[model samples]
Target: MNKQQTETMQNTLAQNKNLLQNEQTLVNKQVGLNINKNSENLDDLLEFVKKETQTFKDISARGSSYVSIVKSENGTRFVINKATNEKLGYPTEIYIGYKDEHLMIFNAEGMAVNKLTVRQTKNKITIYNTKLVDEIINHFGIDFSEITSKSFAEGYFENKGREILYVKLL
Candidate 1:
């Protein structure tokens, strides 16, 4: 192998490692976060983030870092209105991917309306709101009791040494 190629591979691997580490850290923090809509003002919560946490960045098609902005709200902290970004009649959902690659679908306030996951295919990268997906799947099997219908559909399953809450249906 050429030296240049070797160096390139090493650099790629290092970046991947950093991304994984940063993502894991963010996940740990997310577990401790109060993600209730109609709760608090996002501006103040973001201020807390600025004071108590350090932001990490990455280079990816999805995003390099999260862009936190004050939504068009007066003073409420929890705003999860998907229709806020309506152009004509489209209720386009705007989500924010956090430092740990955890996708949060908010309604406009800082409150977390839903969660998303990042997945990779052979030639494509996709993201989806997991909570919505779960809701659909659950509705289809409404007759079944909680977590007893499907083995793979168990929201509380321990997968990959972590508790997976939902899956992105893409």
Candidate 2:
């Protein structure tokens, strides 16, 4: 080969080598970042598991009057603790009414036209309804997207000889 052609080939080979080295460096950095991110995710998962285990133990130990609001992809659930459920007469069917940032649960036997079925477990009574929860959240201007669950203290009152249990949302 001519000297000029030999020089040109050398330059091309150097440029190719540089490009390959740069690409390898970038790949190495990406791999390191991915490893660090995965470690962080594992740590977060472990922490969450520990927290939930402790919460379950605490709930099991207490028979308290409270309302827990839980949000999931399927819908929102209002869970009444066992003590509160007993106070509400262990309702098989319930009427949920919302007004002024308060949700009231009343026994539905011969009392209300609109009613929701109650899902009773040993520790709690759960009522699931999507629209009512959505309306209450929207009306109260509550941003519940980042929140998974919340608990509120319950209050009891009687009106027109009807018993009602209520939780005020803030």
Candidate 3:
């Protein structure tokens, strides 16, 4: 081939090589971006799965013998589980008192102070007192709007020769 024709051929080959390199660089960048996006999505999915697993474990680990405070638009109710009610001999009347951040449930047979009537069922004993519930909420500094109910474990003990079923607030 003539010198001019040969030089033209070399230039064309160089231009083609440069174009190929540019195309490869673009492809590499696109692949890198896809990998980063997929990694972020995977992290989000794993976090969601972890939260769901923890919720399931919490629900499954709860015990039946517990005291619960339930709130509603009408009022609030304190509930004692069947095991606790049986332990207390299923009293129709109880005296509810609070001191030192502890909720005290006393048998009403020998007590005459702040007697509260309670409803007893096969599964639970329920006490309904709106004022008492409000006082507890205020004392505990609890967010009433965020919580619908809370449960606690109880201890039966004797204080000053009196048997009491008490729940310590958190």
Estimate, for each residue in 45-128, the C-alpha lDDT of model 2 and write its tens digit. 435444643333243224453687677775687678887777778888888777566777777877646987777898478767
Per-residue CA lDDT of candidate 3, range 16-52, in tens? 9999978877875664422343352444444544464
lDDT of each: 0.36, 0.68, 0.68
TM-score of every model versus the real structure: 0.21, 0.54, 0.55
Per-candidate total of colliding backbone pairs: 7, 0, 0
lDDT for 78 in candidate 3 is 76
Please give the TM-score that candidate 1 achieves against the real structure: 0.21
Model 3 scores a TM of 0.55
Q: Write the per-residue lDDT of candidate 1 for residues 1-170, one digit (tens) a residue.
A: 99999999999999999999788778757745544458645565655665877543322232221221121223211222222222112223333322232323332223255533333333222234445434544444333333321212111111332222221111
Worst 10 residues of 1 by lDDT: 149-158
Q: Residue 104, candidate 3: how far off, in angstroms?
A: 0.8
Deviating ranges (above 4 Å) for candidate 1: 33-170
